[model samples]
Target chain A: GAGVSQSPSNKVTEKGKDVELRCDPISGHTALYWYRQRLGQGLEFLIYFQGNSAPDKSGLPSDRFSAERTGESVSTLTIQRTQQEDSAVYLCASSLTGAAANNQPQHFGDGTRLSIL
Target chain B: LAKTTQPISMDSYEGQEVNITCSHNNIATNDYITWYQQFPSQGPRFIIQGYKTKVTNEVASLFIPADRKSSTLSLPRVSLSDTAVYYCLVGVGLNDYKLSFGAGTTVTVRA
Candidate 1:
């Protein structure tokens, strides 16, 4: 892809239902990140992936929030049994390399706006 | 992560130089100051970054003082299109660490 891409720009699901958000990062990008932004709030870190390395899942809000990345390409953020509080804009970003590279900026996607009814 | 503080909003006339400052009182030695601009319903776009002193790019300039306690994002001669929310972030690393976005300063460039 030309840049980080996310699917289903908007999603609305009832409470207790499940939702999946997808991200397609730029080619050759080794670092992928997921963030959540609630209404009128700052962006909250969710997870990060670098190549085949173990992902950092420390930011996932709860057990219901989980994410997976295949190699260094596409990533999926799955929210099980969604709650009203889970509604937010899920953003995905990718960088050329890891933290050691100072110039690599994290390019972001338009994001998926999830609404949990 | 170093916590950052910035203004919530600002208003400017077109063709004005707008400077938005962000304070990071506890910035670490290894942290870098980065700025991002976000439009409505869109993701943030990187503007410029700096480790110390001043760094300039085509879009903006980042001025970090010697103490690194605070930094300012200078948008030169901003136009109506430059009206957006600007974020100041301090990150420990380029990749792994989370870049926290505080209540960004919304710059409304009036025509």
Candidate 2:
């Protein structure tokens, strides 16, 4: 792909229902990140992956939130038993290399607008 | 990551230059200053990054002082399309690169 890609641009579900958000990084990009932006709030980092290394999950809000990536291709973020507070834009970004963060500019997708009813 | 502070919003006119300054009092020596611009319903895009002094690109310029405590993002010849929220970020490293965005400075470029 020319840039990072995310699936299901918009997802609306009832409370307690689980949802899966997918992300496809740019070709050969070694770093992928997931973030969320709640209404009227700043972006909150969820997690990050550098190649095949164990992802950094310190930013995950709760045990209900988990993510995984295979090699360096695609990533998935799953929210179990979603809550009303989970409503926000789920953003995915990828960089050329995660080894040097400042040198690599992340390219973001359009993001999935998750609405919990 | 170093904490950053910026104005809530600002208004500018077309053909004028717009400058948004961000302050990071606890910036570390290894940290680099970076700026991003985001439009409504879209994700943020990198504008520029600088370690010290000045760095310029086709999109914008980042000016950092000797103290490295603050930096400014200068947008030249602004237009209506330049209206967006600008974010200033620091502490971009390989080990801990999680970016924490502030309220951001909303620049409204009017015709």
Candidate 3:
């Protein structure tokens, strides 16, 4: 795709249910990132992936949240036993390079709005 | 990661030059200042970035002092369409560092 894309623009699931959000980064982009934005709040970093190397999972809020990326393309963010506090917009972004470089601008996706009932 | 502080909101009229400033008291030496604009229900878009002094692009201008403790994003002749949330980020130039977006400065451009 020409830009980063996310699936299921909106999802509403009951509390305690599991959910999965997907992201398709721009072709050739080696770095991918995930973030969460609560209502009327700034974006919160979740995780990052640089190619096939070990991902930076330091930002995941808890053990219930996990993510995976295949090669350098599609990625999925999975939340087990979702809680109401987990409701937010899940945003995905991709950059041409990894964290070492300072000039690559990250292209973002529209994000998936997740609602926990 | 360096933390940034910016205004929560600002009001402006059309054709006015809006300048939003961000303060990063503990900014790192290698960190660069970048600004992004995000509209309602949409993802943020990169506007401008700078290391030191001043840098201007087609969208906006980034002004950083020699101390690099703070930076400002200047939007010239802002239109109604420019109304959005502007975030000031400090990081090592777009790698995978955790981007801590403080409550962005919401600029409301009225006609």
TM-score for chain B of all predictions: 0.94, 0.97, 0.94
Which regions in candidate 1 have their CA more than 4 angstroms from the true location?
A100-103, B94-96
Candidate 2 lDDT tens digits, A15-112: 99999999998999998899998877777888988885545788899999999999678899999999999999999988888947566767789899
* Alpha carbon lDDT of each predicted model: 0.87, 0.88, 0.88
Single out the weakest 10-residue window by summed lDDT for candidate 3 chain B: B92-101
Question: What tens digits encode model 3's per-residue C-alpha lDDT throughout B1-111?
Answer: 578899999999999999999999998777877888898888888788788999999999999989999999999999999999999888746443667677799999999
Per-residue lDDT for B19-69 in model 1, tens only?
A: 999999998777778888999888888788899999998998889889999
- Compute the TM-score of each model's chain A versus the native chain A and list the values: 0.95, 0.94, 0.97
Off by over 4 Å in 2: A99-102
Fraction of true A-B contacts recovered by candidate 3: 0.66
DockQ of 2: 0.56
Error of model 1, residue A77, in angstroms:
0.9
Q: Where's the lowest-lDDT run of ten residues in candidate 3 chain A?
A: A50-59
For DockQ, candidate 1 versus 2, the one ahead is 2
